[model samples]
Target: MRFFNTEGPVRPTDHYSLPPLERWDLNEILTFIEQKKYFLLHAPRQTGKTTCLLALMDHLNRTGLYRACYANIEGAQAAREDVERGMAIICSVLARSAQHYLQDSRLNNWVRADGALVPAGDRLFQLLEYWAAADARPAVLLLDEVDALVGDTLISLLRQVRAGYTQRPNGFPQTLILCGVRDLRDYRIHGSSERDPITGGSAFNIKAKSLRLDDFSAAEVRTLLLRHTAETGQVFTSEALDRVWDLTQGQPWLVNTLAYRACFELPEGRDRTRPITLALIDQAKEALILERVTHLDQLAYKLREPRVRHVIEPMLAGTALGDVPDDDIQYLLDLGLLRQGNGGLTIANPIYREVLPRTLAFTPQASLPQIYPTWLNADGSLNPTALLEAFLAFWRQHGEPLLRSAPYHEIAPHLVLMAFLHRVVNGGGTLEREYAIGMGRMDLCLRYGAVTLGMELKVWRDGAPDPLTEGLIQLDGYLAGLGLSSGWLVIFDRRADQPPMAERTASSTTVSPHGRSIELVRA
Candidate 1:
């Protein structure tokens, strides 16, 4: 009766899961622990860091090599700049964890018994020193969500750990592992009085190395899905399995959530006799996105951050990343919002690719003016010509104002257009997007009933020439990929000298170099 686990830590008995240790380099980790090196284990939220840490603690304890305990210090986040409160919370949690995990009760009442006398900065150091002295086996501490501590609280924690680094195995924890969504190097801690932010490296210079936990590989994704089949005798078609990998790119929580929805939540998928098919997988993905599930919703919330917008806006518009800082890009990569592909920085996966733009356009989509479905025929088929006309009229009257609602200014036009199209395909159709670094254009494919429409969005900047010829060539390639002879190419005029939106917005018919008919819209 094991199910795919999407929440909290994975328990093998209750959930179908890959062996946690197998996801990491066991030898490297053991080497760090044996050497008593303080280090970091980081990955995006919900990538199974807690599950892995718990398993590692059990492994170390069972081997009789160490007395290990895993404690989540995220609860200390609420203390913010209050160093004393944060330290007390952290110490008490660690004490409870030690008692539970190793039957070590020496530090159980240490927080209430002695913490008030010691300085907030020295409390953690004192607790660890006493705990290590009480055990013959070296104490291995795995602290999860270490980054959740903020400001002065975070600074005190790191400085205390650094202060006690010299006393190892005998006086302090042998191997201290900090786990969080971002590597410690990414921590920019601002203290209450400091003029400049404190880098994590300066506070905790003893870190030996940073290890990143990665998403599951394609093979691992397959193995997890097949486990459900083996247990329930409800098969997943080959295409459905591949679709899952394509959408999630092996993000652990996403894979589990999608599979859980497909197998348990969706009524059609619950039937033991019915094989999970490609269509069902797509339905599950759409449902997950529309439901605005917590995982994806948190990701969408990140788009509002200036750093995130810096990297994402240009990527969305398919423009060169001009003067973007290395740390900003690294931040997105660490958040698992972007990945380093052979093609350079790309959104992590297909599911994210769709989610980012739709999330960006959500407000504009809602603000869209009321307009009848002039683009649809009596039989509910899309009329490409009519759709273009409707869009042109919409742009003339409301597009300029709607642009104000776009998430990022650089890509406002793209967002506004997507908003209109999202309204077009609201309930019955699908909108697929293909944009990436160096692509120089965002390609979109809209499928409504029996009709498919292709589009390419380009911007005509201040110093650039009209993108008409270039867009035609690109749209021709895009249409060919979709196996269609016709599509639309939209060039938003962003040049400083351009006329007003209402006056300049217009469309014309043209033929691509490949002789495919193209509906060219210039706005």
Candidate 2:
């Protein structure tokens, strides 16, 4: 009775999996370790860094090449300032891990030499030295969740590891691998007095190489799903696989979560033998997003951090921040929040693109009832005039209220409008949204059966002139890209002179180049 695991480390006897070791390029990692080199291994949270490290440790230990052990140092994060307390926790965890893996009490004994754990700031290196001396074979150490330690404690840990690098293969651990959600180069240690403020100095430069574990590839995701089918005789339809890939973009946790939910949690007596379908996948996606599970919730919290804002705001505006630091972009990329595309940055996947704006608009009223409906006709056609009139009225009455209450106040007007549109057509239609930090425009495409409506939303500052002409051109281009003849240009006129709807003549319909028509609606 095996099942897909979406939680912590997968055990061999459990309904677990080991994504083919052959599929990953671990030779470089092995070579680095064999050469007694220290390095960093990082990727987005829950992307299997711990699993991979554990597997690698098993391989190394079983091959009789090295004595390997994995320990998480996150517990030391709280005792950051009290170096002594942090070191004691680190020593205790390392001892426990060694006792579990090596089945040898000697490793633990050495760590707790003379019935006393070494004091903070000194325990980690001392334990490493003792273990290297006590072990018959060279040792490989994997430090998981290294980034969880913050401020001075993190700096102390890194510095100690760097200090002990020279004694490797003899008095120190033969190889060290620091695993976390960020690469070492991106480490922004704040309370360190030894490093220069402007240019982060070399507090710890022992890293010989930095390896990033990437998301599952399309083929790999298929193989993972097929493994379950082979075991349980349950099948996944092709369209289901396509939808899963589209929604999760091969995020490992998401893929496993969806599969687990599909096979185990779906309503009973459904069509289980017909192979899962795209609609099922969509259902699971919606459920997960609505649940705001741990992974998604953690990512949402990061949105409030200034570093995330620096990258996301520009992408939302449809503009680029040319002078942005590489580390800032890299941090977001490592978090699975952004992806590299077209030689520039883009939302990592479609699900993120949809979730980012909606999540940013978190508020009780943002999810309020929509007085307007999404469909214009009974035949799944859009009624542009009705849609515009409803939006205009809604905007005039509650537009200010919604904007003022949005979580991301800067993008409140735009998101509130989208929320209104989403509520209206959510049942019968689909809205494809694309916006990123620093990008100046939010492009949206409304799909209603056979007809597609494209729109570009923008906001004008108080002193800036009207953006209708520019918005129309942009909307026309967007429409043409979608092979549509006409669309709407919705602008939030924040300028002081902008009058109410009744007094506003600027909000009207017009035709642009190549006979492309646009209705400029002001809120």
Candidate 3:
């Protein structure tokens, strides 16, 4: 039976899939190809880019309007700065892909050309000229993972393609598509002769436009999930389906992975009579994250990059991001970590919302000592008073040391607290985080069965004033959203003159204008 595909390009006959062409602007793409334009098709990895390009190639070929072939040249990424070797591998891959897709072997014949030699830089250009001349139909070349080729090799490839642009459809490809995680404008190539990085547009100069393959829409997400129901008579509850969209926000890989896990991996999920529930969906979501699956693992690893850190640090800390570069923002977008939101940037999806904090807090959580689950009552209910006391005790003893060991300097205290809470709340509850730029404080809502305890985290920097007033106001608003009467407001004084943590840590209770009692904690 067909299943959800996460490993590679989705095959409609083998995997449940939405029509690939529906994900983007097909008319604009066709217009570019008809005009013989060299362009870029880019989006985050595993967002079904290769699948759509393959669909496009098949569409063009069936219409007999162009001879199209899709080639993944990422295999040459291993060649790195070796332009000659990289070009040779790319040419070979292109030839094989042409033969496999279009039954064309002329590229192989022209590779050697009776022992006649072309310059290393001109090899790709010469092969393209020979291939185009051999076919009466205009050839459309789709190069996947074009960004994987780095340094001088990437430069040489782009330069070679541009050099033969004027002769396209006769001596070169009629239309060329460079497909990768980043748009051509964002390419920062460090070629051997360059003292500094150069933009990809400078290297190619022939690109006409860049098109991004968008994630599936809400309706599309439902359609993909309903495939399991249609095939096996196993139903997904309305809430379960809604939760899928809510968690993934239509990221294709994530949507498919969750459905695949629920339907095929879990024994209860496989029983046709059992309807998938929202709880089950939530379980699958966390399992996917905790397993450190390939897609999520790759994304989390990007956090170590200095460029990625700058934007994410302020985001986690709820402070303003000052003087961040435009290129770094675009790079994060290209990496699929951040998406353009209503007015600014946001973590792309709810799954990412959970993934980022847990990833940052992973180490501190693991290093935690064997402390009792002191907050759990005999009836398994959460004792809020005890939980807060435990947190205070833990903070007094280990918080400072953990903060010193944190990877992100700007958000160290926040991470340590989150790590402590996550380790304490495992197996019986869920932790949800809400923070954003200029919010001045991070709000966390911990749901343990019937208990929903909210906490507000604020940092008082060296020159900043005490945050009690602003934090209480924000806490009241946050409580209103949660339909709660009270919560905790934590202010970490970072001023240089502050006494040692041992001397200053304290907690008290305060009343808001709305008559909600807030437990105020100062550390």
Candidate 4:
């Protein structure tokens, strides 16, 4: 029976998957190859780039039109800047893959070259030339993980590919496709032989086009899960399928992992007669996040990068991403950390949206003082008034020490607030967050039993007027959206001359333009 695949490439007989060619514009790719053009294909890691290349290679070779071969040259990354060692491994892998996939032994001729010595940089160029010459059909080379190679080794490979671009059809590979997590334009080749940092464009100026393999669409997500149902005689409830799309937004790996965990890992879920439910889907996602699954954990680690911080920090603060370069934005998008939304760039998926805030709130959450959840009523229901009083007292007692420990200076107050709330809602409730560039605030909606608390957090920066009026307007709109008659508006005084937390932190009730009562908290 077919099962959902969470690791490695998906095989049709074992895992449910969308047709590889259906995920891309095949006609556009074929036209590029037919015109003897070199191009790039890039996407987030594990989003099916390798699968597409393998399928494309098969299609081309089976058509009797081109001698196509797919190779993963990541084995060369271990050599780092050692150009000679890296290039040798890369060329050897290519030859082996060509023999395995195309059943072509001509890679032997390229590597051996009649015992003639080929220089490190020219190694790949010469190999391709020899392979094209020996093969009866035109050569098509698909090199996966091209960005994994770094330093002079990466430069050499790119230069070698560009070095042989003039030769076409029978002289060199008719089509060379570079596949990696980043577009060729984003490759900033450092430690080059030229003694200066160069870009992949300068190294391989012959690229004809670049294609990004996107995640499965909503419809495709349905088609994929239904295939498993068709094979195993199990069923996914309508809500379960929708929940998958909502949480993962059709991310290929995440979609598969959630389903696999729900159907295979959970004891109750294994019963084929029992339909998969949205609750099961949520449980699966929670498990994946809590375990720090390899894919999500790797993506989370990207937060520590300075380039990533430049993009994410501002988004977290609800401020403009000023001075962040376009390339950096594109790089984050390629990493699946960001996506193009109706307004502008946003976190890619609901899971990622949850991951960012929770991750930022991690340290504060752990170091929080042991205080019982004071917001619960006698009936174990959430009391927003009690929660506000408890937070005010906590801020007066522990805010200074906690703020000193926060990693980000700009968002320290926000982090501390969220960490406190996360502890309260860690069980028996849900906390939803929304922040964006130029929003000037972060909105949090805490849904506990029989109560939903909406709060808007704002910072009063140096030389700026009190944000009370502006915050009120923003909070009014926020409460309107939540369909609530009351919420909290928190204004953090960030001026260098501000008073101590004990003196500055206080709360008062106020009326909004929409006639909603708001608890205005200034700290």
Candidate 5:
């Protein structure tokens, strides 16, 4: 039976999937190919660009309108700056693809006969020229993972494509599509010599348009889940379906992974008589995050990149963007880590918002010093007073030293605190975070059994006024949202003039303007 596919391209016969061509503007794509245009198709990793391109290739070839072929040049990335080796691999892959997809063997013969005669920079151009000439039908070439080529190799490929721009239909492929994780214009090609860095737009100036493949829509997400019901007679409750949409925001791989885990991997869910519920979906999400599966793991690995950090750090700390470059913001958007909407820029979806901070706190969480479970009562529920006391004691002894271990210095205190809280929630509770650009504070809610603890974290930096009043107000609002009467407002004073951790850290009881009880913690 077909199942949700998390790895590689989705085949309809083997996987539950949407129609590929329906994901984009098919009429516009057809027009571009008919006009012999060179363009780009880009999206974040695992968003189905390759799947769509392959389907498009099939559609074109089936029409008998063009000799279409799809080739992935990712195998050449290992050559790095070695243009000759990279180009050779690309040409060979293309030749094999032509044979497999079009029943055309002339490209293979041409590569054997003329491969060495052409210069490294002109090899791709020559191969396409020969293939287009050998066939009466115009050629449509789909080059997947085009950005995987590095440095001078990438430069050479783009320039070669640009070099062959004018000779289409007969002398070169009538339509060439470059597909990658980012738009070609975002590439910064650096050579091995003293020459300056080159922009991809300068190298591939002939590109007529660039299109991005979006995540599935909410309706599509529902349709996919219902397909399983149609086939297996096991249904997803309305709330379960809504939960899936909320968590995944229609990210293709995430949707498939969650559904697969809930319906197939979990023993309780394996019974075809059982219906999927929201709790099961939440359990799957928690398991997915804990496993750090390949997609989420790769995303976590990208947090260390300077450009990514430049945009992410401030967002995590709930501070103003503070002069971040537009390119850095755009890069995050292109990566599908952030989205812009009427609510403004936020992490793309709820799952990503949860993942980023947890990923950052991972090291600190693993290395936390020994502390007794004083917060756990004999009955197994959490004790708020004991939890606070335990945190204060932990902070007094090891907070300063542990702060140094945080991944981002600007948000060190936040990560260190989260590391401690993660220990409290460990196996039986949930820690939820809500922070965003211009929010000026990070709000957290810890739910353990029947008890809920709301919190608001504010950083009191130099040149900024005391955040106590603002934080209390924010905490009051947050507590109301959680239907709680009291919570904690933590203010981390980061001013250079402040005393050391042990001397300055303290807590006191207060009241919000709305009469809710507040535990004011200043550290």
Candidate 6:
């Protein structure tokens, strides 16, 4: 029976997937290949580059237009230090791929010929040339994981492909597509001396065009999932589809992962006629994030990279970083970590934004508990007076130590303040957190039953007077939107000379146009 595939490439018999050819923008690619144009195909790992290449190869072979072969050079990465070993492995993989796809033993034999097999400096290029020559139809080569090789090995492979570009259609392969997670232009190689800088020598410049495989569109995602419905008669409700999109932004692996878990891993009796709903998708998202699956973990690790931070930091602050280079943004987009929105760049999906902060600070100390009071009067309302009094006392005693011990020292004061509130509110309610690098502030929404409390947290910098007036104005606006009577503004006076838990209270609630007054609290 067909099922959702989260592992490797999906085979037709194993899963009902989008026709692989239809998954990519193949017309543009084929047009370039038809013109004998060498190009690059790149996308983050597990976005189906390999599957797309295999499908394209089958199409080319079946149409009798070209003798196509797809080979992965990832194994060559292990042999990088020894060029001869790497070359041999490359030739072997290529020969194996060609034999499997074309069933042509001669192609392998031609590659293994005396001078052809071991052409010293450019042995791999000679092998490719000989195979292209041996084929009746012009050969199309898909070099998967082209970026895996390092140093001279990577440089040699690219230069050889460039050197043989002119002989295409007659001597060299008619079309060569280098496939990898990153574009060739981003490749930085160091020479044998280890000190020699080879920035722009004979690199791979033969690329006529570059194509990136993108995540499924919203419509495409629906279609892919509905294929399962069509086959198994189990439908995903409209809300479920929307939730999937909201959580994954149609990221291929994430979409597939959620569907796989829901359909296959959810409790047996629960897979009845009841359609999968938004709630189920939410559950799957929570599970996946908590589980820290490989793909998500790897993506989270990339947030530490300076290039990723360049884009993410501003977005978190609810602002756009000005004029990020197209290539850099595209790299992140290709990785399925960020998406372009009408407003600007945002984390690709809500789940990612939710997971990012926790993932970034992956330590037991970072997992501060959320604090909320329960067992209030039966109306689901919190005892505001008691809660406030208790928090004040707690803050007075341990607040300084907590602030000093916060893991993010740069933002320690603000984090500790939030942590304190969270610890107090954990048992009975929810706290929504929003903070971005360079945002200079954190927004927290505490929900205790029907009582909604909004707080804007800012750390006092350079002994500046508390931003109480500004905080009151912001809190007033927030309360007005929520149609609430009052709210609290908590500011951390990081530079204050006063002892911890020292509180200054001001209680003239400013009334908004909507008649809601915001009460200000400064600690």
Off by over 4 Å in 6: 80-82, 106-120, 185-197, 268-270, 317-331, 364-440, 445-455, 463-466, 469-488, 494-523
In Å, residue 169's CA in model 2 sits off its true spot by: 1.6
Residues 1-523, candidate 3: write the lDDT tens digits: 9999988999888999898988888899999888999999889989999999999999999999789999999999999888778988988898889889999888877675721377678888888888888878998999999988889789889888988999988889999999999876645686543336755446776788888888888999999999989998899999999999999889999999999888888888888899988978888887898898999999899999888888999998888889988878888998888899776888999889888888998887877777888888899899999998998888888877888777887878888888988876786788889988888888999998899999999998987778888888899999999999999998888888778786788899999768899999998
Local accuracy of candidate 5 as per-residue lDDT tens digits, 1-523: 9899899999999999899999999999999999999999999999899899999999998999899999999999999889889998999999999889877888899888888789999999988888889878999999999877878888888888878889998898999999998775645675653135655336776778999999999999999988899999999999999999999999999999999999999987789899999999999999999899989998999999888898899999988888887877887888899988998889998899999999999988888988789999999889999999999999988999999899999999999999999999987998999999989989999999999999999999999899999888888889999999999999999999778899999999999999999999999
Counting clashing residue pairs in each candidate, in order, gives: 0, 22, 0, 0, 0, 9
lDDT of each: 0.91, 0.77, 0.87, 0.87, 0.90, 0.72
Question: Each model's TM-score?
Answer: 0.97, 0.89, 0.96, 0.93, 0.97, 0.82
Give the clashing pairs for model 5.
none
Model 6 agreement with the true structure over 1-523: per-residue lDDT tens digits: 7888898887989976888788777788888888998888888888888999999988998998799999998999987767777787888889888889889777578656654546646887788788888867999999999877877677777777778888888899999988998755545566653335576543776778777788888998899889888877888989898888877777788899898888777773147576777767766776787789998888888876766766765554333467766756877877777766775566777677766655544432344443345325567577766666656655565565666564445555555555555455544565566655345556667777677777666556565666766566666666666666766666656564655455542223455444555554555
Cα error of candidate 2 at position 73, Å: 1.6
Ranked candidates (lDDT, high to low): 1, 5, 4, 3, 2, 6
Clashing pairs in 6: 370-426, 371-422, 371-423, 371-424, 371-425, 371-426, 372-424, 372-425, 372-426
Quote the positional error of residue 61 for candidate 3 in Å: 1.5
lDDT (0-100) at residue 104 of candidate 6? Answer: 78
Clashing pairs in 4: none
What digit string (tens of lDDT, one per residue) describes model 1 on residues 74-107? Answer: 9999999888889989998998898898787778
| Global local distance difference test of model 5 | 0.90
Misplaced by over 4 Å in model 1 are 186-188, 191-196, 199-201
Query: CA lDDT of 443 in candidate 4?
Result: 95
Q: Rank the candidates by TM-score, best first.
A: 5, 1, 3, 4, 2, 6
